[model samples]
Target: MHDAPLLPVSRRQMLATSGAGFGMLGLASVLDQNSVHAAAPVAPAVSVATANPLAAKAPHHTPKAKRVIFLFMNGGPSHVDTFDPKPELAKQAGKKGPGGKWMPTPFKFANQGQSGI
Candidate 1:
């Protein structure tokens, strides 16, 4: 027979009741240690907005342009149409590629600008 006395509450209930006390006990020990170490004077609080580099600031000079045009082409232009114009692919248009049959762009890529880039 078990010699231990049975409580009115279940094991789960006992644990739930004592859990907060155990947490507070641990917190008290931490606070006591912090109090001893934190004898040094605290620094003055600085404005976070002013300190932040990304914070918006007034322009140094008066702006000439009132409106801004932002062309956000998600994929921009295709690599085949812009930079890499594969002449061999044009010759073998209906040939098999690495991933199934190669589909070439119908439009002709011209040398653009002085740099031609």
Candidate 2:
């Protein structure tokens, strides 16, 4: 018989392919009786531990920074009264907030030889 020209697969063409499932496995089992009757005696049974395609593994190295601390204050207190104060902040506290609203300083500042916030 002469070879026929191969036809190209077109976008409009529809395919009807039925896959082999458990029924095909059953058929394979029925038609595979010869495999059970081996001519030579079998060797000792080996463990069937196949390599896992998706298995959990340990990380390569130790991680640092076990904790994260964030202290959020809506309107922070006066700098000088609380911690290291800057005289410039007290000089311009109510003048204008960080976002432009005139937010008064929560606490008072003073001149401790070093100008207070």
Candidate 3:
């Protein structure tokens, strides 16, 4: 018996079919039970010391600051005083800046607290 000749496949049709076929093949290999790249079995540590798995661990390193004060001061005293203190801008008071004239901060910038950070 003579073997049947293959049909002429267009580049567009071949690419479309082959892309799907390759994707399916890759998915099948990944989903296979006896795959070489299978995930390792996740076994929990069954130790007496680590009985409570949900327990919090000790700090890796002692923090420099004891208390953290997160002040979200938008166009407030903290923003003007602590963070962005424009001394030059203060000197050039009423002078023409980017948008308008440079207005100096009312509150003076000084080291208040013990550790003035």
Candidate 4:
């Protein structure tokens, strides 16, 4: 039977494995304190057991919007031409504006969904 040589663990290796656990412990203490303080004077103790430090909670009142979608257009096509089509502006295409001539959108607009806006 061949015996394998054991290598010594470095400081960096030890920290990398255990650093996250230390960070989590620190985070938990901060969250516990914040939850206790954030609760109302009458129900201060309730928050310690009921409050979730990480989970998302609903607002005090029901929100009109259930979900939201954000579009981040960076160094691409124009948003007005692509998503929000202005039919009135299309009619006045090539017309002289206050600054310069109004340029028309190359793409055609078509209704897609039942709630067409």
Candidate 4 residues lying further than 4 Å off, grouped into runs, are 1-52, 55-82
What is every candidate's alpha-carbon RMSD to the true fold? 16.9, 20.6, 16.6, 16.0
Stretches of candidate 2 exceeding 4 Å from the true structure: 1-82, 102-104, 108-117
Best by TM-score: 1
lDDT per residue (tens digit) for residues 1-117 in model 2: 999999886544523222346567788876675576535556637533335535556568876879989988788767545565445775776675668955444765465785432
Relative to the unseen true structure, what is the Cα RMSD of model 4? 16.0
TM-score of each: 0.34, 0.19, 0.28, 0.33
In model 1, which runs have C-alpha deviations exceeding 4 angstroms? 1-45, 56-83
The per-residue C-alpha lDDT of model 3 at residue 107 equals 75
lDDT of 1: 0.79
For model 4, name the residue pairs that clash.
none
Give per-residue CA lDDT, model 4, range 7-43, as digits (tens): 8999999999899999999999889767956655474
- lDDT string for model 3 (1-117, tens) is 999999999999999989999999988987884676777767767753388767777779987898899987666555436565677877899989899998887977777688553
User: Between which residue pairs do clashes occur in model 1?
Assistant: none
lDDT score at residue 111, model 4, on the 0-100 scale = 88
Location of the lowest summed lDDT over 10 successive residues in candidate 1: 41-50
Q: Give lDDT per model, in order.
A: 0.79, 0.60, 0.78, 0.80
Instruction: Please report how far candidate 1 places residue 37 from its true position, in Å.
Output: 28
Error of 2 at 80 (Å): 11
Model 4 residue 83 CA deviation (Å) reads 1.8
Q: lDDT winner between 1 and 3, please give it.
A: 1
